[model samples]
Target: MADDRPPSGLRSLLRDDLRGESPYGAPQLAVRAALNTNENSYPVPPEVVADMLAELGETLPGLNRYPDREFTDLRSALAAYLSRGGEPIDPVQVWAGNGSNEVLLHLLQAFGGPGRRAIGFTPSYSMHAIIATTTGTAWTHGRRSTEPGRLFTLAAADVAEQLGALDPHLVFICSPNNPTGTAVGLDVIEAAYEAAPRAVVVVDEAYAEFARPGTPNALTLLAGRERLVVTRTLSKAFALAGGRLGYLAADPELVDLLRLVRMPYHLSAPSQAVARAALRHTDMMLSTVGVVKAQRDRLVAELTALGFAPVPSDANFVLFGGLADAARTWQALLDAGVLVRDVGIPHYLRVTAGTPEETTAFLDALAALGPEHHLGTEKAS
Candidate 1:
């Protein structure tokens, strides 16, 4: 074998701050049931698949040419989709990237750099800090309520106070936040915006479609706020995760600034075609939302009945507590061929609301462990 030592080794070639850092990703194991990663449990409807095939076939021969640098048609489709919320948005206000993660990266590249700082209310999406730091922007770990049962709660005054003190260049507000599955109210969004006069306030609504009936989307608050941005994805609700289309809506001028950072024709023609085709069948693609929401409710109810404290979730996953040993429980579930997320929170694990069959598999596996995985104080009644 060739010598595989230092100099050419990754550690030696990596940046100083990135030397010991690990990339963010959930485990991709071959399991009977995978309730981790919060993917839509349903497959794309066959009709939508047929449409995507047709679009791809028509666009394939043109692959030799570069995709539209602006992805104008995709932007218009996204704009139309958002219009259903009763807030009409112009196509110019939309920006997209390979995924919502890449859209976030573009934001950091455009608005944040070495001298600037970005702040996020934690136990939120971990990627917020990761994206900020990777872009050379200082990352500030802001606090959320940590009272016994209020781990994911964020108050407007608390967020405003943090913003005023940290005065960061970017603020991430993950409504229907990941890991915890808790959503922040518009009051918190407004408070952060008013507190940080110069910061770009990002409201990540990746799971907005799964929110309870009355839950409002941050898109409603975008009328006149030039600094406010709401990022969403087709990955979660549209069953298009593999297509990797994530987009945001902001002021036309603000969205345009992202173009400065994005590589020319960053989105492939296939991606654009596939996303547009899926958008045409939005109703069918979203037919499972009600089913998913019902399953999510079932998870909350059943887990509560089992003596686990499942956080009230507006997203498609549930973050539960009362584990005697979270790591042990996580491994036991894996051993049983059921996988959930170990989100680094003590005594807690997050599981996605999948099909009834998958949900049953996860619940059955956890129940089979009996009292071994439960805290003595959390014994089921």
Candidate 2:
């Protein structure tokens, strides 16, 4: 049998910090309804695909040379696209990476390291802690109330208290936080900045475009706060997950610092070309957002009606509770040709908002399962 131990029995050679760590991923399973990862289920609009292909085709001839190290034009397009959020941003203030995870890795690479620390509310983005660990930064599990009713939400006072006491060097707050879909308030972010005066505070807005009306984003607060960062992705709302474009908006000086840590010509020419093309058709790419949100809302109402407690979501997925066993329920759903995420939450499972028909597939699968799978979320709580 192949041993799972570090290759060549090199346990002693492996970094002590990385011991016992498992790489993060979701099941890439085939099913009739795949509502596991919160990916934008819609295909890119045909016209945008043509545009991407045309733009990328031009870049193909230049593969012999390194891509523009600065990625000037793509940055301009990203800034212009971000500005639609009611906040005008200069191209100098933006930087990108293969994915938001890499963008985060760059942040920790620059601002975090041995002898420093980072804090994030537990069950936020798992990668926040993962990146901190790999960078030799101490990961603090900033906790919120576990009491019933409040339900996975963070408060501003809690932010101020934990950050002030810990005095970490880097912090992350995810709006429309993953797994739970709870959107953090701006007041909490401001509190985090105030509490960690010397730290770089990141607001991860991967699902910002999916937020319902009146759910404000952190972009408006970037004006005077030099230490603040707002990270976004094309993977979710823009329906460009395969294109692998994630970016951040921050002070130009901070954007410059990332250059010190990043590899030369980090973005490939084709990557930049495709992203720029998609950015040119921002409205069309994001046209999927409304439909996804409608399905998201439908997931909330339907899950609740099915006796599971569904968290209010501003993102493209719903985390529903009241399972007798999340693992069993996940397997049962998979057996029934539907796949959902068992996010390690005891009684909860999260499902993505797919096309309306796919939504029906998931719901219908769940309805077919016996009630023994769990209790009502209200009753469970």
Candidate 3:
């Protein structure tokens, strides 16, 4: 549903689809257990913070000069970082932007435009549609397998059927999909690329670090596929959301073409410096991944025990159904100083896996709910 929330005077000047659509954001409320936006709840380690400050200090002297328009060193660092995925990603095969969203926007700007189409499955990232439409590329919302036993699984057959029907210019596969928290199989991605021979297929792996063991990332499929892209971010696992660094791995030729859509010196000096510094201490920056994952698993188990059905998540959040009233539960949690995401699902709400203390707070608040909140749950200690 398009949000008809924008003003009247700007309607004539704005793109028809965007005129009334609100900018995307989760609630930014202050709470005791703030698990709403899927951001890593951990602060950057003090040691990493000091090193980042040192890196920024060195860049202050060079601020007069524009950042490396090519982001040479940062690209090398990101390439090296991604190489840990076992695919040996070369710097030439990497392209970056302010964040993964900008990387998506760059992809849309380069390949998707007026008269072109971009397609992504529903219950996935909303940005895929927003960016496509805003870039003047028509957006086609795809569906997951409707068969029983499949909640949000995107099978290869689904990819084949959808691609055959739409033939879009861009195809987005968000593994460890948002809201639902389920990862897509590498087979599904392969099917998308093979089926959409004429389209650019993007796999958004912003939460790849939190995926369960044996969950294969699409980075392994990049070789020889010029149209396949795998985008990663330092925001979630790396605790670098403030650093605003996100990059993608693709064929060198594709990376070169993306450079065309980017403005001169788009990555600022300090932004590049901080990102490089954080990348250098990737281990320290990502120290909280295990803790977050534990809390995520705890959420799934406890929610199930509480009579709510929680989706198994490969990402650092849980989406639980069985809420008698999702909106009321959201408000009650807020009143109890806990915050979560409503995600537009009627009986479901998404909560980020936070610190152990935060997890306890959320569970305690939830278990306190009575029949007014849901019938499936028992309110007990």
**Predicted candidate 1 versus true structure: per-residue lDDT over 21-45, tens digit per residue:** 8999989888989899999989999
Residues 1-381 of candidate 3 have per-residue lDDT tens digits of: 986665567576786677658999888877888999888999988898899899998999988888889999999999999888788999999888888999999999999999999999998999999999889999998998656568888989878889988888999999899978999988899889989999999999999999999999999898889999999999999977877889999999999999889888899999999899999998888889999999999999999888888989999999998887799899999999999999998888999999999999999999998866774543531
RMSD of 3: 3.0
Residues 1-381 of candidate 2: C-alpha lDDT, one tens digit per residue: 988665557766899888778999998987888889888899999999999899988999999999999999999999999898779999999999998989999999999999999999978889999999999999999996687887799999988999999999999999989978989889999999999999999999999998989998999999999999999999999988898999999999999999999988999999999999999999899888999999999999999898888999999999998888899899999999999998888988999999999999999999888877866533444
Clashing pairs in 1: 176-183
The per-residue C-alpha lDDT of model 2 at residue 52 equals: 89
| Top lDDT model | 1
How many clashes in each candidate? 1, 0, 1
Q: Every model's Cα RMSD, please? A: 3.5, 3.0, 3.0
lDDT, candidate 2, equals: 0.92
TM-score of 1: 0.96
Please report, in order, the local distance difference test score of every candidate based on alpha carbons. Answer: 0.93, 0.92, 0.90
Model 2 bad stretches (over 4 Å): 1-8, 376-381
The TM-score values for the models, in the order shown, are: 0.96, 0.96, 0.95
Backbone clashes in model 2: 0
